[model samples]
Target chain A: MIEANTPLLRMVRYFWPMVVLCIGLLIIVAAVDSTGDIILAQTLTEGLVRMVMVVALYMFIGNSGIISFGHIAFVLIGAYATAWQTCCPYTRDMFMPGLPTYLLNNSHHVVLAVFLAGLLAAFVALIAGFAIMRLSGIAASIGTFAFFMALYAAYGRWSTWTSGGSTVSPMEETTTPWSALAYAVVTIVAAFFYARSRWGLALRATRDDEIASKAAGVNVFGQRLLSFVITAFFCGMAGGLYAHFVAAITVDSFYLKMVFITLSMLVVGGMQSLTGAVVGVVVLSVVIDVLRRLEAGIGSFSLPTSSAEVGVGLIMLLILLFRPSGITGNAEIYWPFKGDISSSGAMKRQS
Target chain B: MDYAIQTIISALSLGSFYALGALGIGLLFSVLRLINFAHGDFITVGAYALIVPSSAVTATLLIGDFHPALLVLCIVGIVVMLAILSYFVVFQHAQKSSPATMMIISFALGYTLQNIIVMIYGGRPKAAGIWSDLTGQVQISSGVSVQLLQLVTIAVTWILLIALVLFLKRTRVGIQMRAAAEDFRMARMLGVNGKNVIALAFILSGGLAGIMSLLFVTQTGVLKFSMGVPIMLFFFIATVIGGMGSLVGSVVGGYSVGIVSVILSAILPEELRGFRDTCVFILVIIVLLARPQGLVLTKAAKERV
Candidate 1:
């Protein structure tokens, strides 16, 4: 490993490549926006939201090595949090009479709504994590899944607050591409820093060997809980962005479909690194966009749209079969010209 | 008294369904350490096997037109074959991977299978009128009645459970599977064929799924591509709550979930009925918190450091 003078320097060295990639992606999306492609702009914005969510997922799952299915539950909570604050007064009055007067009468700014959404989700995670973090292995996974199921059921039925499983529509569509990109960058930087923090290293140590970490005075449960809450905050923000981007939200949107896609992206990217999460989202998004365009009939050689989903599933399976560690295989891509930080050397260190 | 009797009977029927599904999942987990997400798709495949593939609103009976006994055997055989094929084709290749990876692969397989069914039959729910004669009510005692189908379901589940216990106790293959479940690496070193035992478990699991599909279709009289998911979810929860690797624990867990579900539905007000499942899930979390290893802890459930 290359010696660094300080922890900050070491973190920068470890994560600069990921930061460069996020910036590059944002610039490309911004360029596309200048061309006045609304559909492409919206797709990129939605993709950025997903990127934030997946990276947030990587924060907890990568460091702790626990497969959590309940993170999407935070997304649901976040979306509804924004929905309560940002929905138009008339719609709020008509459907959500249970809301407090401050939220129901006056629509809040999107930025504040998104912030509160993350805060609310983080609060929920803090409460739930205490009970959930005590368990380990597959038992913890099942517990999180149960938590997800319960949240889904409760949200789907709590009609006065959540519109009782029906679609709550026409929220203020204020999440432009630039705003989403900003959040995505913030999420990426936060995750990168968190992963290099003392808590993050302790969690990874515990993940690698729980008993040894405990012997080394690492509070495994506390570290995992911290990661869980932090990740939930970002995921919740992504959820708020998704609600505003789509201009409508529903309970069903945050169910199995979201869970499968996000988890697949994270796993396919290699669940062990920040680089893997970002690369997985960007790569899968491009492939999906291509397949969707093909399915919609490009030129005269058109295929059915259903085939796109099949192709995605097939490709994911093949990837898992051949390279289970994912395309990046837990290695970060460093700049080649930076001779002090060799890419292959980083790979060797990680492996 | 009558309401209590009706609830008890309903609980038994529901418990039986969960028990069978849990056993299938538990058996696979015992040997493979895989929580097979595709197990639900196997049930769906079994249900669909009864009807010819078409995009119609109602399904046309394929094997359902056969004699009931032959129909059950044919469906079970087809499902078992499918299970074995999946093991060899997909899971066997990923045998050395982590449990999380294997779980995702199973999810992928399940998604692929569901999509294939959707392609063949369209996404609409179809009416599957199988054994319509069994829908009649049978009076069990004074002022109490139960569906004939429920009675049959209960009988079938118990019979299968007893038969399985006998098979495990008396047969060489069954004993070998138990040994592998106890300690797979040790069993392999002690002259047991790992592949053969695992294949046997898959067959038995698939057979259980097949039976569950038939019973479930007959009970609901409708077939949808996703009908198996709810059952699979409950079965998964049951397997965990019963103790992950123990067959007997799976049964007890199933009954516990079933009883809780039945009582909640019976006692909850009309408006709160939809939240019954949520309550059951919360109960599961509490149980998990109380005993993370599960209520029926097996020796194998302990982590080997």
Candidate 2:
């Protein structure tokens, strides 16, 4: 069997398609980065950052088929953590007087702060996942939503550690299209490797048939918890990227609207494929950009404001109606015409 | 004591809205496996019905000028029509899709409805002047008082709940609905009309939403485009904690949340009061961990995933 090949051979074969895709994406981002238009740069950075989040979303949801509502919570935690580490030391102390003296006195490098932000979020996810992963089906989803709300509430009022509901600002503006592109590539690769891992396969099997997988020795809860934490780490880093890019942070930015927009991207892209995640982000980002332009009026033919959201809603409906499985229909865009070169192949979607 | 009675009345008053919302969402969910996220939109549209758009930026009383009963009836009728129209135009086409697809479709539909509301009423919260008489407070004993509207809310909610109970138990269509909720495909094979049952569910849910919105705006005295979001969140929590498909469970869960919220607000230090909802939701997660089937286990929910 093609899947029965040697380990090294299988790894190389799996690597073939993902590397090509990542390189292709990198080239596109580089071209966009070269455009030198500030608005285009802003949109490109936004799209790439979102791509990181959607990819993280795909890592867990694509494998487990659970639509998580709390990944954005990690983004929130990460941004705040990054804000703590990278905000101006004087303002940090003035605003967040509760931070330890060391953090209040010294600002860390932005890159290192980002990594620490991800670690903190991953740590929180690990603890939370233990309780959460025990639940299956809609209960698990609702559990995540609960976790999200709890975290948001706690942070919103932790006035000494945060600016409370106010914006956290005066730090860094380090995220560029190039840096965001790099993060997106790294996230995509991580998601690809994670999905191709034995743990990912075990999780997917549980998703497909939990009873059958349990009989076959899959630790369903553990697998789910693992994926959940991994997704949290990526989302945390994505949030870190977002904070540095915007040069400001606010708790509200990572709330319900962000949750819906990111989830919509994953669903529109198809929930089961890496290609779907990236493709969904790019397509929707471009559509939103166009709609935003239209809303601003391109030479007296302007549409109403907030019509972009309507356009997104409508496109999502049409996608769900015409392609219930999403634009990718649960299939990864592999190296085409090579005829199933690696294992995993096409997903046997029971949805 | 006066304190005890006041707390109970307040608890019931808040619980009424939650129970109504949970009933609608749970009913639709049981029959179709669709969470019907657009139910919130129905509530919002019903609230906005009191004041039709006078201009793009402002609204004036239209049918709200009618007698209170007729005004209420007119709002319920409009929401029901919206529900029926959505079923025909959107949900009917996606009948064969997955629960996830149906849920997403409902979300998008909700988004569309919210945008439409914003387009008509603008994003500001409007000071609605309906049932102003109910705003008056009622004194029961020394140091004991409650809003007259709160009592009316309790009365209206219970009356409606009783009516729904009777309808579900005694009517032919209601029995068909219960059968469909139990086992949709089997019920269909046994000659239950899937389309008709689903349509009836939408109607009942929409009417409940109408009533719930009325009670909601009457108490709050304000309406915003996104007002439904928070109400829907608690309704979702109630449905889940109550047990998704069980009617009594939904009502029980709603009251438990309401009572617990009031208790928490009363008991917690002022600093922690802001976290009352967070605390309730965390408790929900714990309950799920202990009983994923919910507080009231259902025969259908017992099927292991």
Each predicted complex: what DockQ?
A: 0.65, 0.62
Tell me the tens digit of each residue's lDDT in model 2 across B40-158: 88998998999877434445778767888899899999999999998888888888876666776888899888877776567778877777888999897879999999899889889
True interface contacts reproduced, per candidate? 0.58, 0.65
What do the candidate models score in CA lDDT, each in turn? 0.86, 0.85
| Every model's TM-score on chain B | 0.97, 0.96
Query: Model 2 over residues A1-351: C-alpha lDDT tens digits?
Result: 444467865566657657766887888777876777889989989999999999999998889977788999999999998888998767777889999988888889988999999999999999999999888776777789889988997888888898889888877789988899889999998988888789989999998988999999999999999999999998999999999888878788888778878988988989888888888998899999999999899997998767888888888888887786678787765533333433445422323
User: Isolated chain A: TM-score per model?
Assistant: 0.93, 0.93
What local lDDT score does residue A43 receive in model 1, on the 0 to 100 scale? 77
> Which one is best on DockQ?
1
lDDT against true structure, model 1: 0.86
Task: State the number of backbone clashes in model 2.
Answer: 0
